[model samples]
Target: MRLYVTPASPWVRRVRVCIDELGIGDRFEYVQTRWPHAWGTRTVEMPADFVEATPVVRIPALVADDVTLTDSHSIIDYLDGKFGNHRLLAADGPGRWKAQETNALACAILEAQIMRRAELLRIGADRSDDFIAKMRDRGLRCFAALEKQVPSFGDAFDLAQITTAVACGYDDWRYGPAWREAAPTLTGWYDTVAQRPTMKATEPAETPER
Candidate 1:
């Protein structure tokens, strides 16, 4: 199996953390991909087969045997089912729905963070302050929502927690500590989760020049 990734992407990091937590990191090869800039102005040169595997050109693309999974959600689902015995995610029942709900909020926060970064990358004249502000506000709103849901987050470090931690980590790295104000309880939860070896190992970093 080959996992295409960029260190700076929280989406990619989510999958990496899951793989590590499942003790399946050794089963796959990690292929580094890059964006031209931190805000993903464009992709750096990529291998032809990688392009074939992920025509959409997204990170967290996984190629295993005859199957190619694009996008972080699909990759994680595949890993949880195939390699993780549904440990990262529940197979059915109320637990699956609860995990899905929490994951949705976390994924939304990630989307808002990335969109906010893209807006910030624009030139002063081209940037829309209103749009940037909208993304920031949306992310904070989700943070608050997650804070309320944290108590329900049981003992297992499942997919929801992994994704939520990734979102928190990215918000810290890209947008600083402002989100903590909206999610004080979540802030405490994340501080503890961030210490995990998987989280520490996959900390976000600058995309290197190819």
Candidate 2:
């Protein structure tokens, strides 16, 4: 299997973390997608190799023996089905639904942050006070809701934690570490999550040129 990813991407990081946690890193090759040092731009030409390969040009696309899957959630769902004993997504019932729901919310938080950051760079403004306050408030609200719900997911890493960690990690990387001050419980949760080998290995750092 080949996993195409961009190091700074939370979506791609989620997949890498999943593969690492499953102790199956050797089963897949990780290739860097998106040009190095290129920011806020994407070129969407299907490679001659993958012209019939897949319809998507996004990162975290997984190429299995005969199948190509895009979207991190779908890719993880496939992995969980094959290698997970109902670990990432619950094996049955409402638990699966809830996990999916939480994952969606978490993704939204990350998406909003990404868009906000893009806007910041585009306009040559760090971040507008009103813009940031709105985003921070939204993130905190999501964080609070997750904090109350995460305890029920039990000890081992779950989808909720993966999404939460990636979102918070992104904030730390692109925004400021002071978010730890605004969301302490979430920050503490991240600290514990970061101790996992997968999280440690995949944690995003500013690209060398940045």
Candidate 3:
């Protein structure tokens, strides 16, 4: 399997952390993407070749002998089912649903943050102020809700733990550590995860575009 991803992407980080945690890191080659630049400066669009390779104009596209999967959640599902030896998601029942629910919330928070960043990059103030504010509020509300729900995990790193950690990390990267003051429980959870070797290995850093 091969994974085309950007190191700074939390979606890619999730997949990388999972691969390392599940001890399948040796199976795949990690390809740092050049398509975003190939498309255009400061644009989300990718070139036709990249699109043909992976329809989603995003990072963490997994390509195997018979499968080419995009989207973080779908990649996770594929990995878990293929490598059932180390199950991150619950095999069945309510626990699986709970994990899925947390994943959904985390993804929503990420999407909001991404949108906010993209809007900031736009050359003009052409976007609706109300829309941006609503997105910001939605992200904050999701973080607050996670703070309440995440405490149940205690000291273990499961799917919920990984997803929430990535979400909080993304917030700190795109927004700032101010979110910590508002959501202490989530702060603690993320701090604990940050110490883990897997999370540390996948941490994002800002860089000038090449």
| Winning candidate number (lDDT) | 1
Q: Which structure among the candidates has the greatest TM-score?
A: 1
Question: Candidates' TM-scores?
Answer: 0.95, 0.82, 0.88
Candidate 2 per-residue C-alpha lDDT over 1-210 given as tens digits, one digit per residue, 9 for 90 to 100: 988777777888888888887777899877655433334444444455443444555567888996789888789988988988768778789978887777777887787786666445544454476775677777767766666665565576887778878988887888777567656776777888888888889988543332
Alpha-carbon deviation at 191 in model 3, angstroms: 0.6
lDDT of 1 at 115: 86
Tens-place lDDT digits, model 3, residues 1-210: 988887667888888888888878999988777533323225455556567668757777888898888878788878877885437888788878877788778888878876776665545566566766777888888888877787466454767778888888888877787678768988886887788889888888652254
Sort by TM-score, top down from the best: 1, 3, 2
Model 1 clashes, total count: 0
**Ten residues in sequence with the least summed lDDT for candidate 2:** 35-44
**Candidate 3 lDDT for residue 110:** 78
Q: Please list the residue runs of candidate 1 whose C-alpha ends up more than 4 Å from where it truly belongs after superposition.
A: 38-45
In candidate 3, which residue pairs clash? none
- The local distance difference test score of model 1 is 0.91
Between candidates 1 and 3, the TM-score winner: 1
